[model samples]
Structures are given as C-alpha cells and as structure tokens.
Target: MKIVVQNLKTGKVFLADAPKPAVPDNGILVRTSASLISAGTDRAVVGLARKSTVGKALARPDLVRRVLRKVKNDGLWSAYKAVQNVIAEPKTLGYSLVGEVLAIGHRVEGVAVGDRVACAGAGHANHAEVAAIPSNLFVSVPQGVADEDAAYVTLGAIAMHGLRQANQQLGATVLVVGLGLVGQIMLQLCRAAGLKVIGLDLEEAKLDLARKNGVLIAAKPDDPGLAAKVAAATDGYGVDAVLLCAGSKDSGAPFEDVAGHCRDRARVVVVGDVKMDIPRNAYFKKELEILQSRSYGPGRYDPDYEERGRDYPIGYVRWTERRNMKAFMDLLASGALDMQVLTTHRFPVERAAEAYDLVIGKTPTFTVGIVLTYGPGEAEEYKPAPKARRKVPGKVGLGIIGAGNFAKGVLVPAMTGTGGFDVRGVVSARGLSAQAMKERIGAQYSDSDPGRVFDDADVDAVVIATRHDSHARYVV
Candidate 1:
C-alpha cells in the first residue's frame, strides 16, 4: 500500500509503500474512495511543520526556556536531543475519509464487511488507499449517498456539533464568520436548522459561493457600514448567535464586527481560533453567552470512547461524534444537504504531491476542496504506466501531472532522488507549471495536456497529482 505522510516538523510529504496492514482488534479496514483535506486544521499542521527551527523555537519559547533551565540546573543536553527526536517523527494527514469496509477485527460489531463508512480520527483515519480505523470512528453511510458526498461527513459533523453547542431556536439569526470549507458547511447546517445565516469573509469569490448557496447575506469582514447592513437584514434586533469559523496564525483577536452587531444575550459559539479576550464592558452591556465547540462531541479525545471498545452512556448523550457522522450521511442521503458545489479538485494517489502544492501555494484557480484518490489497482502492486506501453530498458520514466509548490518542495525532490527513476515529463492544464517542472527537474519534455504524457513512449509510470474532480478520470 502507498500512503502520503508528512513530517510533523518539516511539512514534507512523501509517497511511500507500507505493508498492507491487517484489521486490528477494535478496528476495521476500509478501501478508500475519497478523503477531504481539512484545509484549516491540516494546513495549520503543515504550516507548523514547515516552520524553521528558529521559528518553531520562537513560537514555543517555553520549550526553549525549559531546555535552558535544564542546561543551567543539570548541565543536561537531553532536552535538546529530545526535541530533535520529536521533530524527526512523521504525522499522518487527514480525517475526513469515506470508503467501503473490507475487513473487521475482533470485537468490532454492528458494521459489516462491504459497508460504506465515514471514518474520522487523527492517525487511523488518513488519506491512503486503505485505512484501519477504530470501529468507534466508523459511521455507516446511509443508502444513496455518493462517496464524494460522504467524504464530507467528518467536517459536516463538526459544523453540526458546533451548531448544537450554540443551541439556537428556529427563525433565530446567526452570523458565520469566515466562509472557508468548515464555515460553509456551518452555513448549510444552519440553513437546514431553519436559522438565518449571514456569511462573512474577505474574499468576494467565497462570499459569492455562499450567496449562490442560499445564505441570507454575504459580506466582506471589513466592509464599511457592515453593522448597518446586518442590522437592516435582521430588522435591527441583531443576530441571535454567532459562530466564529475563521482560521489564521493570530486568530485569537475578537471580531469587533461580531461584537458590535450581535444582539444582547445572544449565544456565540467559536469553532476556530480567535484572540480570546472578552471585553468586560461589552459583555456586561450585552450579557452575551460565549462558548467553544470541540471538534467531536462527548467522545472527542476520549481513548475509551473513540479508540478503545468502551461505549459511553448512550441514553443520555445519544449522538457521539460517530453518531453525528451517521446523521450527516443520512442528511446527504436524504437530499437535505448537497455537496456538489464544495468539491473543487481531485488527484490520483501517485500524484499526491501536486495536490499538496496547490493547497500550500493557495492557487486561486480551480480551487475549493482538494481530494486525493486511489483506484482499485493503484497500490504498489501495480504501476500507473499504460498497460499497452512497452517498458523501456534501463530507464524508469515518470509522468507527473501536477506542479504546485508541494510538488516543487517535497514530492518532486523525492522523485528526483529516486535511484532508478528518470524524471521524464510533467503536465498541467496550463503549460506554465509543466514548463517550470521541466526546468526544475530536468524533465525531457512538458505539455499542457495530460494526454501527451499518457501517450509518451518514454514514460514508464504516470503520476497523477491533479484536483479531485479529475481523479476518477485519471484513475480510469
């Protein structure tokens, strides 16, 4: 099996082979159809990994201070060595995975083999051809839900859980700050809950998407007279609640616009980072209720509830995070929510690096959600080269189809370092990336059309790293 893993401290990802793992006790193995790259959470992790040694130390000065303390007290360099060891480890990427169950382990019940399931967790649920996830994290996909739609289960569950925490009533007005993927999901969920959704973002493209999707209003965060517009939309009563879903390096700062526009005693649930300072005067005047929503429900971060076999008290808290995923899938299966507009791109497994590059570079074109795909025979056992093409003697030629920064920084570097493979060619929709890759890696040729790479006689293996929408086509 081939999996994409990133070094936790280096933000470097490599496509490497791993043993086809067996289903362990309390877990189930699934063949992945699609997985959503959680932009904010995963990007935060990637960004942390990409930070320089000095930057990391600056960010976590306490760690450095602790090491200094050890140096002064015991003359021990162990803390420095420990930090280096911690930096050397690799972290698995992804949690929003939808796939079919291939096998089940001992003590795993309720879900059968061949069942379609949405799996979410840190290490067990990942972007790979196959994953072994704890049974507790696997939620059955309802009938009629497409694999791509089900890929949103984890994120949808997150939005839903946050909404639940807010506890808004029908016809209540709500503000969703930051219309990223999660925020957009919250918008849909809020609409489903019969609440008014006012979407906020800096990008007109994102706000445009929200408006097209039926959000009550979409506006820039810094638009002058924004409070008046929101007040007019809400009949001067202010919104009943606000869900903060913005992500930034320094997101802890209060969104002054939200504080200004919210009605007195309104509930505010924060799902993303924000500078968490409460102005006593503002709170005292408004009597606002502020809350923070965790990623999963009661089962979140609980080893016994999510990782081990122990089930929680179901009667009191009926919907665990897994159950929330089940509810999300049910909503999709019933046509209550549509995921068609959310998925922006797809890439095949071998070209995974290209997918990461797009996310890192923040390419404005053809971007929304990015998914990595793997076909039935895409494992290490089979090469992605054309079956009809004859193998070249002494040359392992590769055809790369994505040329984003991630490819430039990590995967391409790894490919260039491969002992036997020759960087034969690359392709992108536009010739710019292809040409740049040709120059950077000394590829023999480049083309804007993928067909050229597919037809090239010298290419022995084709690596797909395009968007999610393109994955099925490339795989087929």
Candidate 2:
C-alpha cells in the first residue's frame, strides 16, 4: 500500500510502501476510499515539523521539560535515544476517512466485512491505503452519502461537539468565528438547530461562502461595526453564545473583540487552537462562561472506550465520539448538511504531496475541504516482494510491525548497527512509513499488512513499535 508521511526532522513529505496493519480484537481493517485533509490542524502539524529543532523546542516547552524529566530519571544515552526517536520517525497524517471494512476482528460487532464506514481518531484513521480502526471510532456510512462527503464525518462531529458544549436553545443567536471548514459546518448545524447564525472571518471569500450557505449575517473581525451588526442581528441583546473556531497563535484580540458582542452571561466555546488569554475585566463584568471543546466528544482519547470497545452509558453520556459520527452521517443522509459546497478540490492519493501544498497555500488556488480520492482497486490484498536469490547466512531475520519514530530512529538504527540482524521487512499502517523504513534499512519488502511479516519463513523475530493501546494486541 502507498501512503503519505512527513519526516518530523526534515519536514520532507513523501510516499512509502508499507504492510497492511493487523486488526485488533476490537477493531476493523478498512480499505480507504476517501480521506479529508484538515487544513488547519494538518497544516499546523506540518508547519511545526518544518521548523528547526530549536524552534520546535521553543514551541513546545512542555515537551522539552518532559524530555528533561526523562533524562533525570533515565540515563543520558536513553534520554538522547528517546528524543532522537521522537523527531526521526515519519508521521502519517489525516483523521477523517471513509472506506469499506476489508476484515473485522473476532470481537467486532455491529459493523461487518464489506460495510462502508467513516473512521475517526489520529493514527487509526490516517490517510493510508488500509487503516486498522477501533470499533468505537467508526460509524456506518449511509447509502445516500457519497464516500467523498462521508469523509467529512469526523470534522462534522467536531463541530457538533462544540455546539453541544454551548448548549444553546432554538431561536437563540450564535456567533461563529473563523468561517473555515469547521466553522462552516458549525454554521449549518446552528441553522439546523434553529439558531440565528452569524459568521466571522478575516477572509471575505470565506465569509461569502458562509453567507451562501445560509449564514445571513457575516462580518470580518476587523469590521468597525461588527459589534453593531451582532447587536442588530440579536435585537440589541448581542449573541447568546460565541463559538470561537478560529486558529491563531494569539486569541486575545479575538476574544476581547467578541466580548463586546456577547450578551451578559453568554457562553463562549473554543473549538480551535488558539492562545486563551482572557481579559479578566470583560469576562468578570459580563459574567460570561468560557468552555473548551475537545475533539469529537466524551469517548475521545479514552482507550477503554475507543480501543477496548467499552461504550459509555447512553443515559449518562448521550453522545460518544461514535454517536457523534453517526449523528453527522444522519444529517448527511437527511440532507440537512451539504458537504459538497464546502469541498473545493479533489486529488488522487498518489498526488498527496501536492494536496498538502494546496493546503499550505503553495498552490495558486484556494481550498476549504480537500478530499483525497483512491481508485476502486487501490485496496487490493497485500503481495510480498520476490525473495532474493542469494541470502546472507547466520543473520537473525527481523520484521517490524510499525515504522514510526521509535522504530525508525531507535530500533532500526540499533538493529542495523549491531550487524547481526537482517531486516526482512517493515510493516506500517501507512505505506509511506513502511517504504521509508525499507529504504533506510535496505529491507527486502515493505507492506501495509503485518501478516506478511508473520507469514514469512525468513522472519525469525517480530518487533512491535505501535501505540501503547495497540502494543498488547500486537504482542499477543
């Protein structure tokens, strides 16, 4: 399988061939048809990866502190190797993908093989040929929703979760800042919830897009009469709630600006990455409430809920991440949310690097929701490369299941340095990582399916370097 990956150390993006991943007992293997490129989130990650080591350290002081703590607890060589592994590995990108279930684990239910579903989460739903997704992070895609549109389900769940945090009622007026992909989705959801929606952004084109999509009142953050516009839209009471969906390094100005436009005791929900330097006086005087919306919903980042498939009680937790995804798909099926208008570009998965260039504004055109398409036959069963005619004797044949940072920067280097191991193959959920590892180690084969490694007669040992939640399953 072929997938896109970014080198954290150099920020160079490229394609690689990897093995198909093994499905966990509570997960399913998906053959991706389409994946959504999140401009804000993914661009931020790429930009950080492109920065110098010092720049990265400065940007994430907390991470530096954590490294320091590791050095204090562990020896310097161990700490150094850890940091090296952290930056040297290639990272697979994309969190929103729609595909068919090629196979299901023994414990998986509700979704069967050949079922069309939308997957969420970071590593589990990456922009790869095949992804091993936890059962709770995916939802069945309705027949009416196209694969391209269904790819937006994860982002839609994010917007829906942010709205849920606001807890607004019908006929209330809400202000959605940003007007980007997530903000645009929030605007449509607000309208569907019967709230009068006002959209704001720095780009006139985005504001225009929002207006075309049922946002009657839209304005730029710098508009001198912005407060007055909100006042007029809300009959002088200002907006009942503010959804801050904008991504900025410093959110002080936007928050301060919106403070004057919010009614007394109004709620503010931040759905994007931004510095939250709230003005004490404004929030104190207005008695405003500020809340932060995590990605998706309640079950997000909970391993027991997502990986182990232990669902939350519906009575106590009405909307888990999976339920939110389902709701978004339901809206798509009911025609309440139209994702087609938000999509501006589509590229084949082979041209994924160019797609990222578009997202980063290297291209001459603009895009809001970019979808990466895959051919019908792109998800065929894995086939190992032909074996070498002559093989080295007495070398321990090794196959690694993940080619991520730890595997690439630490394990592979150590194995090759020892001069006693022959790396037969490298397998990663993303093909790019597998391909990169194969090139780095001069391995015979790289694949997206780990089963190839296990089945190989030459492979005497297997290494698992995946996430902690996946380690046990891989080990077993």
Candidate 3:
C-alpha cells in the first residue's frame, strides 16, 4: 500500500509505499476510495509546518519549552538535533475518508467484507490506499451517498455538532459566520432543522451558496447595516444564536459583528479555529452565552469508546460521535444535503500535493471542498529491502510492530534510551509512520511485514504495541 506523509519542517509532501495494515479485532481494514481535504484544519497544519524555523518555534511554544529542557539535559548539539527531529516529524493527513471494507475483525458486527463505509479519525481515516479504522470511527455508507460525498462524514459530524451546541428550536433564527465547507453544511443543516439562517462572510462569493440554499440573508460580516438585516430577518428580535465557523488569525475577526447582530440572551457556539475576544460591552449588555463545540461529539477522544468499540448507551448519551455521523449520513440519504454542490474539485490521490496547493491558495482558486480519489486497492505484500544491520555486541535486536503515538513517543524512546537494544525494524498498520520511526531510530529496515521480524534469526525480541485486540494474534 502507498500512503501520504508530510514533513512538518519543510512541508514536503509525498506518497510512500507501506505494508498492508492488519485489522484490529475491534476495527476493519478499509481500502480507501475517497477522502476530503479540510481547508481549515489541514491548511492550518500545512501553513504552520511551512513556516520558517523561528516561526515554527514561535507558533509552538511547547516545542520551544521542550528544546529548553533538552538543552539542560543533553548537550547543545544533541538538543539542536532533537529540535531538528521535532521539526522534521512526519504527520498523516486527512481525517475523513470513504472506502470499501476489505476485511473485518471477529468482534465487528452488523458489517461485513465489501461494505462501503465512511471513516473518521486523525490517523485511522487517513489519505491512504488502506486504513485500519476502529469500528466506532466508521459507519456503513447509505445507498444514496457516493464515495466522494460520503467522505464528508467527519466534517458533517463537526457541523452537526456545532448546530447541536446552539440548541435552537424549529423556526428559530441563527447566524453562521463563515460560509466555508463546514458553514455550507451548517446552512443545509439549519434548513433541514427548519431554522431561519443568516450567513456572513468577508467574501461575497462565499455567501452565494448560503443564499441559494435558503439562507434568509447573506452579507459580509462587516456590513455596517448587517444588524438591520438580521433584525428584519428575525422580525426585529435579532438572531437567536450565532454559529462561528470561520478560521482567522485575527483575534477579533467577527465578534463585534456577531455581538451587534445577536438577539439579547442569544448563545454563541464556536465551531472554527477563530479566536474569541468577545467585546464585553457589545455582548455583556445582552447577557449572551458562549459555548464551545468539540470535534464531532461525545466518544470523540474516548479511547475505550472509539478504539475498544465500547459504545455509549443511546439512553445515556443521545448523540455519540457515531450517531452524529449517522445523522449526517441520514440527511444525505434523505436528499437534504446536496453534497455535489459542496464539492468543487476532484483530484486523483497521486495529485494530492496539487490539491493541497489549491487549498492553501497557492493556485489561487476558490473551493468549497476537494476530494481525493483512489483506484481499487490491490493487496500487495511487503517486499524485503536490502538490509544493513548495525551489529553491536551484547545488545538485543528489538523489532517493533506498532508505530502509534504512544509507541513512538514513549515505548521506543524508553527502550532505546537504555542503550541495550538496537531497533532492528518497524512494522505498523500505516507504513508511513513505521518508515518515519525507522529512520528516526536508525532501524535496519521498515515495512508492513511482521514476518520480516518474526522470521529473522537476528531479531532478539518483538514489541507488540498495536490495538489491544490484535495483541493475542501477534503473540501467537
């Protein structure tokens, strides 16, 4: 399999060959068909990563602090190299993808091989030939949805969660600040909920979709008379809620506009990366409430719920992440959301970098959404590469099977720091992560083949750090 990996330091993005990932008992192996590129989230990462070294350090003070700590512990040269390594860290991109289930875990139910499913997760639902998606992170695609449109599952869940945060009643009036992809989804969602929607953005072009999609009013956020428009649309009561869906470096981007146009006691739900510097005077008099919407919904960051498939009972939590995603799909199934209108560009997975160029404005084009298409993934085994082993006396040859965050950040570092083992090879579900870790630790080789390690007489021991359900299979 081939997967996309981006270099954080230089912003060099490329596709690299990797081994086919083993499916966890609580997950499924999916061969990706389509994936969505996020203008806000993915763009932020690429933009920040492409910044100068000083800019990168400034943007991430936590990394700066780490460098300082490293200086105190290791020598300056080693600290500098550590900083380089940190800057050069590779990240898997794309969180929303639709694919065909090539295989399913024994624990998986109500799903089978050959099912088309939409997957969501930072690393699990990536822009790759194949992804190992935990059951909770994916839902079967409906008959009505296409692979490209079904790829909107993650963003739709995000937009739906933002709407949920507002808690508006039918026919209630609301304002959506920023008519980007998520904002467009919000527009349709608000319409589906029978809510009166007002759309605001800096660019008039962005508001066109909102206007066409039944938004009562579409105008620039800075329009001096925007409050009057909102007032007229709401019958003089102003909007009942404001959903902030724009990302900006400006701390005070549209808060004043948001505050001035909102009805008294109206709530503000922030769904984007834009900073909030609520004008106390502008909003305090109204006694407005401020709410923050987390990504997707409940069960989002819960490892047990997502990775272990421990679903929250519907009786206790009405809308878990999976349920929210399902609602989005249901809307698509009911013909509420025209995913076609939302998608503007299509590129083969091979042109991923070019697609990103369009996203980052390097190509100077407007877009609501970009989809990366993939060919039917033909399963390929890991072909052994020529080996060069660092033979050291009295040292164990350690082969690792997982390159997840915990494994790379903790386990590998702990073992290597002991000066008693040579990291002979790495095998991970996502080959890109394994390759990165192998180069970082000076491993002899990296691939998706466990047999490379299991069959090698030089390998002294193996560490199984994959999902818990797969541990027994690894042991056997």
CA-lDDT, candidates in order? 0.77, 0.86, 0.86
Residue 144 in candidate 2, Cα distance off native in Å: 1.3
Best by TM-score: 2
TM-score to true structure, per model: 0.76, 0.91, 0.90
Clash pairs, model 3 backbone: none
Error of 3 at 346 (Å): 0.3
* Candidate 1 accuracy as TM-score: 0.76
Q: Point out where model 1 deviates above 4 Å.
A: 61-75, 249-251, 362-366, 378-476
Error of 2 at 91 (Å): 0.6
Clashes of each: 13, 10, 0
lDDT of 1 by residue, 1-476 (tens): 56677865667876754434446578988888888887778767777678898887777788889779867775666545444444543556788888888889888888889888888887777887878888778888878888888888788888888899989899999999988888988999999889999999888888999998899889987888788888998899899999998874465454555888899898888888676766767767899899988887778998888878677778989878887888888889778788888888888877777777777764546456777777874444454433333444687888898765556545666776766778777776434446556765677766555777787778888878776666787764
TM-score of 2: 0.91
Q: Could you arrange the candidates by lDDT from highest to lowest?
A: 2, 3, 1
The residue-level lDDT of candidate 3 at 264 comes to 89
* Model 2 misplacement above 4 A: 382-384, 398-416, 426-438, 446-476
Scanning candidate 1 in windows of ten residues, the lowest lDDT window is: 383-392
Tens-place lDDT digits, model 3, residues 289-385: 9998998999988999988899998899999999999999988989988889888899999999899898788999888899999997553534446
